[model samples]
Target chain A: YREFYQCDVDVIGSKSQVNELELVQIVDKVFGLLDVNVLVKINNRKVLTGFAEICGFPDKVVDITVAIDKLDKIGLESVEEEMREKGLTDGAIAVIEQILKLSGSTSEKLASMRSLMNGGSASGLVSETGLKGLDELEELFGLIDAAGVKCPVEIDLSLARGLNYYTGAIFEVKAVDFQIGSICGGGRYDNLTGIFGLPDMSGVGISFGADRIYDVLKGLDKFPKSLASSTTLLFACMGAEELRYVLPVAAALRSEGVSVEVYPEPSKLKKQFDYAEKKSIPFLSINGGNEAEAGTIQLKNLTTGEQKSFSKADISGMKAFMNM
Target chain B: YREFYQCDVDVIGSKSQVNELELVQIVDKVFGLLDVNVLVKINNRKVLTGFAEICGFPDKVVDITVAIDKLDKIGLESVEEEMREKGLTDGAIAVIEQILKLSGSTSEKLASMRSLMNGGSASGLVSETGLKGLDELEELFGLIDAAGVKCPVEIDLSLARGLNYYTGAIFEVKAVDFQIGSICGGGRYDNLTGIFGLPDMSGVGISFGADRIYDVLKGLDKFPKSLASSTTLLFACMGAEELRYVLPVAAALRSEGVSVEVYPEPSKLKKQFDYAEKKSIPFLSINGGNEAEAGTIQLKNLTTGEQKSFSKADISGMKAFMNM
Candidate 1:
């Protein structure tokens, strides 16, 4: 199926052996770091199959499902027209439309579907496969509750992911505040590996569209400011001799987990200071002939205009001065 | 030109305006961090052109250079055959072969080439364009020495990069210990952006092939072991209730810069331990019903088999324990 995010499966097994509850938990844990509100909408292909069978158009399942999948993009009128062109009777089209309009809290929707399946006029309409799909979704929701997933999990019957291979729960994640398509999507597929001569294997997966997520974060100004500067301190030298003296000190600071750089080529002091300023380097250390002989460095705080000399041995003090 | 690494130029200006000295300094500084021995080999297209002119076939410059570029891959006999096919006479081909065989220290090679250009009745045969190329190389070497670049710089006459666009210095970096092709390569292009409506823009750059460097580092076992694990601590809870209790604690640890994850779903203790072991998570914090009620967690060091109980206020202590 086409999706914005690249998909990767967590577990692969037969359709009946796919662990729906564990999948929900895994998704919940995976998305736990997001500060913004998110919704995980789930649906099942079997539900669509049962609905088509009950509507007396089981042979036209793929066509009906394909039309319904484009509902959001093409609207109800176009979907109905497409289904009609596929030879679906108006009555079967009406039944599919009613199911698409089903909505409520996850449990409330499940309850509504159950009543529709068992009510006198509608009784025996939903196939056993449809009931099994509803049961699987109910178990998934129950486990999600038990696991205390922070994100909302909704049973969106209208979310018919456009893929004929999906056999069980399909998941689509969307940001609550962002007006965009799904940031993540995936579903369970049966016998995917069977095409490669490994039979009966099923799999389920979800993937986050990293580029879209980055765009969203950028639009929201959520990126931390400190990420811009890789160098915490820059050593400004007066000449090649000073550079030679400062190289080892810079290397030692790097070894102590401090990101440091030595100004190559003894340029003008103003140019070196400008370089430090543009790079957002807070601390600038100068080891001229005097400092080099004394085994000390003159450290300047670009933000504060404060300067001090620290002995070469006091790396921790220098680190504290730089607030690294 | 196609290259293994993605090339990016630091300085761009007209051919005559671009400062070649600054380019050498920039390259020297950029590669200063590499601990392994590296050689920066330099050549010039103008020198190749001048050599072709002095050999009495200026119009065959491209053809002769193309043939010689394959010298390392196809050997001297094949290069001669290709040059012959390109219509270079035996005498001119002999001269080009002699130049290709010229080898020594960088300065010694320059001395030999200078004498070749002015020594015999063939003296003054080398054009001023070729002499200018020699002069640029001499200036680049002078600056490299003055800048005290740690890497060895070499001038090889046979180092003819196949690209016809290079107007000045061409560089290729080779790791001394590695058997792969050049890890980095680039050259000065006279009017690279001119084709895009920006005329006379000369640019010089070199690019490090990150994938090749990574492969070399991997083969040498130079990658740090700590890169394998992202999580420093994992909390293994007994049930959903304990999981809820551990979630906030894990978040707090994460806020303090300790990579932490809570075992989702409160799986079996053995399974949780196995996950921590496989992921190389050094610390496992357990907060079951009793520990949850006591507002403390029993943190175990998976590697050292040390266990200790810490209260909620002891996050700083746990940070120390994790060495994060």
Candidate 2:
């Protein structure tokens, strides 16, 4: 309801970390194609829950994640203050802070988080769930490395933005230069279909932020030039008889799969050319009394200002010229 | 709300008969492409009004045309009964019958109607509007003939189907063998925008009866086969490693504008093949452990049972085989 259009590319039925890598690669490829720089930040619900448990606040995972999600906006002090208000002691808060501040490459962050979780919390709580999520992250990053994803991927300990339904990897994509909020985001749901009376189906999905992507493409002026019009060639209407002479020829080129349009009226040459230019038609075929009488057409390349002659019957030749 | 969608192809600012001919030709081409046989029936409002005037019921043109429009379903006696109830004399009814029964080609029918209108009604009323509509119809058919429209075009004297705003040519297309009613219809409105306070701007438009055409296509089994999907090829997932082996290959083929899908699951070969068949994916790339290690792909043309081998790096060769 918050976004304009949400299309989930759901990779259902596989719990393999390969699916997680595929999602990362898709995020990379889509932004790469759009010429937008993006960072794919990933975290796991199990890992976040593990952090909460080792902090001796296992049942308060949601509260901890909600507060820390604001760490970037309100700063670490405010985040820790919110955690303390949720009934966390200073020792528990310090341990959680140490895990959140673990920064390095994906592998290095996973290693440090593993050692810190293994070191046990102030209340001596150990988290196997945290270790499991770290393993999944390591495998996902391994596959991502093998696939050579071009976009940057990050391990964000503070990301718990996906709805509480997600049981595994959580993905949040942000435009590096665009000021718009997350341009795309989704996560893994281990039992998404269980609420529908279907049990235990694991899926990973991502939704592209269609509205933000459009704004990004528009703001950046990255839309391909060819989408202006599919009209490959235009036949200028010089005279009624000339228009009559070229109709069949234009239809011929169209039948051969060349997009062709004939000026609807016998307007002035300047007007016809302007119309073609406005519609972004690349080539124009011009004919006058002499050419019509001789059964010939003068084809002009609007882009290059090159002119060539073709017999009125030569559809393939005209199409080849248009292609060239 | 009556039809699922009604898209009117409006040709504005052009009162030329060429535009009418183009509409007719487009109807012909669209129906031809859909593999549905259609009869393009044309009538002019002026000609209908002229008939009413010459019948001494110029003030009752709407009543007269409305009654006669039902003549095909209600029969001549019933239609004449309704006309008489609306205050037409026997003489006027006889003259109307004489004109309605005039059967011939478009040109011949136009000529006879012209003669009959010139002969005078019971009140000795003559209609130049009738002559003008007849003349326009003649020019329109002339263009249609010159363009060699493939579908049957008929001047239906009883046809007054389009709403009363039409000032010139009226069109209705019906499936030749289908039991349903008109599949497409429209007319020329000389002052369509006048009601909206934009006067004297004439336009010709036809709305394709999308719902009916879809039903017609379904009834006659006339829809094109390719519309079922845009996917050109599917890479079968035999195993995790094989799927990984083909992901980049699938991405490469996709970059070349080929619609390729790598089966998202490493299921049984039979299951993957069945999935391909169900999705109407034409060609499929298959690989097992041996093929994955050798960096080779076995491409299968599912429709033809032809299979070919290509190395993983030989994307162009694999694409060519798919094309073949």
Candidate 3:
């Protein structure tokens, strides 16, 4: 079997659209932390249901959404052709094209869709389900704005998420500047637990491709430099005597949450320093015979080339200095 | 397919006994963090080989060790019976029993076995390979003692690890007080990568069963109470107006590394507090109309029944207070 790994977050219970809004906030927070600019395309399935009804072929909702889902790949004309081949009339195809192509902010676009679904179009269409979808979108977008979600969000009418089995808000996230497919997506399911025997439990969830996110970070060079080193400091091994002296100090620093690596064997100071440098360790502690006799530690900031001395027993002070 | 998960750690490119020492230290550190008392059993395959030679059946090493490996479940008389059935002379079986049953400290046991294997017994046998194994074990144990591994370390003679494919420094870890299977085990392999075409590389490694460790932790009630709560603080949602008031404050606290959850919908004060209590959220932030007007937050520590007020914009101070 083909295998890969993806992180999934699922929230169970509650019919409140606030879960949807919170999911959008999660997308916003995640991308914000990763320094990735994103655009969240959101739509509701009820709106698509109303769209199918208004277009005079409610039974063909799956066909229409599946075709529309390919708009980015096959273009509008080909999507229309696909819909035409799926038994939709020219008039219905035109209505699909017009509504999905409506250009505005998420709120403005929902308003336009609401007007069209309310018989503003020449087809004299009116759909309560579609209007409800519009209302949900309006309220969700309001919550997102009030929460100050950082990413740009849009109402993409054609983003039916490929006939996804969602009953409420649908979400798809893409990196704004990266040339890749959707990095994250999820939607609301009216009966997420029905297959396992419980019914009518509404829930929303999202999953992001970890590999794509890693690629985006790598391609854009956004990974932190600190990640290159696992050890925050390296204590140079002078000999058995020095190792004994620094053993407790290293343990103290470790307990204080600093990752300290003590060189296992005595080696040339130059060799030890090179080992620390190659590993990108930020600090180096040297305890030779002199330091051992003097009962002090000679610490050097590898990055800044700053040197300082500390009492051998001042574990907390040494830790604080390294943190600084 | 049956499936499970275990974390594996492998260290490559070192032939020094220190690698074995480090692996033991890792076991010590992991169990130390888990608060489990464990005994680390260490042995070497070469030593087993030498024992077979000293037992007068150099060609029957696998059979002798295999029979001895079952000593725990099958008892000594049955093991000797099985060995005799496999063409081991009764004298050899007696020798195997004598050496494996040496009752002493690890060092004392090794010393007794060293004298016996050096032509002290009636078999008048000596094994260079077995001597090297003992030497390697001596160095590794010395390093472990010097490095001050916290867990008890022992040398086990009958620990053949079931015909395991290891070359040196075998290890198995068991909880001292828990009646469960071994939680961790591993050993050194002389040519780990030779199967994939890279040859002659030496490595020491260990794998601990995550499920078994979890079971031990759970059965012993060692899991931390802090693992129960994810949200550090829950803001009581009084209404849309109050939610808006706490939105930025929650964001600020979240940016300061505090987990902040804003109740999604307005509800009665008791209901909101019940939600916080159910989720184990320690801190509850209430910013009702009065607090909103006063530009302050009414924060209560649910666990301690302590209340404090902070200026709405002082996120750091609020974070520090929550941390305290």
Candidate 4:
């Protein structure tokens, strides 16, 4: 089973263009640091509603939009059949298809959409919401372009998020190099808290699918080397007497912000050293039964196999020697 | 309906004096920064086992430990009855009472225990595991004393953490000023991951109850003004088109590391201004219908009630004015 971890940032009582742009900026900063190229496509459910109105299926907007949104996966033919089953007419289906196919540069796309949907006829008036949506979409793009964001911001007309709450700009972020689906997504919801009796408030936020990002980074070999950073020293002891001699020395070094570990129990020297070797621990402090009586300790550099004995009385010298 | 958050740090795969003392130093740093006086009580489960074995309820270690651990909630008589039900003898009960009464400096207490348990055929060599535990506890305190950690550690013989996994040093941290229970607790478990088929490995860890800390700070009014830091500026808009003009400017300032919020929608000026006031938002950027065409914006400092108009071309000037 695959696990998912949610990394969400939310703003309460906000549903403005500035909020939308700031969210985009945050997304850019985080993923840019992760060195992942992305495509951020946006849509407005209101525009889909206008498309529904022009198709004479105003009341079935949810059904029509839901089916059309699955066109990428289930195919256009299957969506059309689903629409037919939902009581949408041939005109409605054609309008939906035309809107889904709408594409061009920011301004060109808006111009093409306006001309196709606005015929100066009654049905054209029915698509008034669609025309207004184009105006809002233009404003969103103008903000993105002026902000000089490097990532592409496409006007994906068929990108209808299935949630019924989104009222304005809706967003989905897709990784450019990975075959996975959208790794980050969110949008504006005008009256979510209204269900909790806090009406008319709007919010916009985004959630990063942390588990997916972890997988993608692992697959790309992008995780930083410091992820596995651990203790620099492992104190080795063969029995109870040795453990007593090294205890104070280990404690003194640890107080100075050093990462240190002590092997518990009086195990065999080889077994303990092998355990330290497997963890890639670089230094070993060994206090044998003889050393305990002598009040001395030995430091071994695991990497170079160097060993040196030090007087336990000169704790300061040991600190300097260990570079703690 | 209270809320809480946990902050967890673990020492996995080792249980050395160095690992244990380093954990103490980290805990000291955390609590020192938060500036709260705490009492850290230290104990060992192996000692608890010896106490149980000497109490003639060796097979009922779990039940006996669980009962006595609740001594703070229930009285001593209740614990005695629970021990008796587990088939404890009068000699065992007397030893249990003596253990309960044990206290002093770490070394002094251990020496007293040694004399009581080991001298003159008192309790059959004091159980080898119990003697081993005393040695471990002595080393632990030697490390603490050598480090000069500021927090006080109490050697509580009755402090048995009831978890099934812990094998060595158990710890509990409590704030001296608060009336709540231990806000942090953990211990060494020698074979936790072993249950997942990785045996003989040991780990030590502690978890800080962030929610409880938050409550404690809230009770003491210790959270500084900077804790709830939010954006300094809120761009207020008159209509959808006007919001388009201010979005990019907000984005640019935010990119420069200034926290910013865009007022959602172009509602009435009064409503937007009041919303800003409620959130204690400091500055208001008003780029309404007229300002949009002129390519200028109004900046209002809510704190000083000072308002000024500036050209959009003077974005650097606006940033300077807002102290970005």
TM of each candidate vs. truth: 0.60, 0.83, 0.78, 0.70
Clashing pairs in 3: none
TM-score-based ranking: 2, 3, 4, 1
Estimate the overall C-alpha local distance difference test score of candidate 2. Answer: 0.82
lDDT of 4 by residue, B140-228 (tens): 88767765678888777656665576788888888888877788888888888887898887888887888887777777677765555
Which scores higher on lDDT, 1 or 4? Answer: 4
List model 3 lDDT by residue over B70-164, tens digit each: 88898999999999999999788778877767888878887887887787755778977888888888877777776677889998776766445
Give the candidate number with the greatest lDDT: 3
- Expressed as tens digits, the lDDT of each residue in B11-41 for candidate 2 is 8876766678778878988888788899999
Q: Residue by residue across A212-295, what tens digits does model 4's lDDT show? A: 888778877778654654877888867656666676777666666667777866788899889888887778988877887888
Worst 10 residues of 2 chain A by lDDT: A116-125
Give the candidate order by descending DockQ.
Answer: 4, 3, 2, 1
> Would you list the clashing residue pairs of candidate 4?
none
Fnat per candidate, as a fraction, reads 0.00, 0.04, 0.23, 0.42
lDDT of 1 by residue, A85-174 (tens): 999888877777777777777788787776555431132465777777778777667656644556778876666666577888888888
Report the lDDT tens digits of candidate 3 across residue range A1-324.
035467787788777666787788788888998899999999899999988989988888889888888888889999999999999998998889878688866667877888889987657778889889888988888777766777888887667664557988899999988888888888989887999898988888998878888888998898988788988989888776777777667766776688988886777999999999899999999988888889899889988899999997788788887873
TM-score of 1: 0.60
User: How many Å off is the CA of A231 in candidate 3?
Assistant: 5.3
**Ten residues in sequence with the least summed lDDT for candidate 3 chain B:** B156-165
**DockQ metric, candidate 1:** 0.06
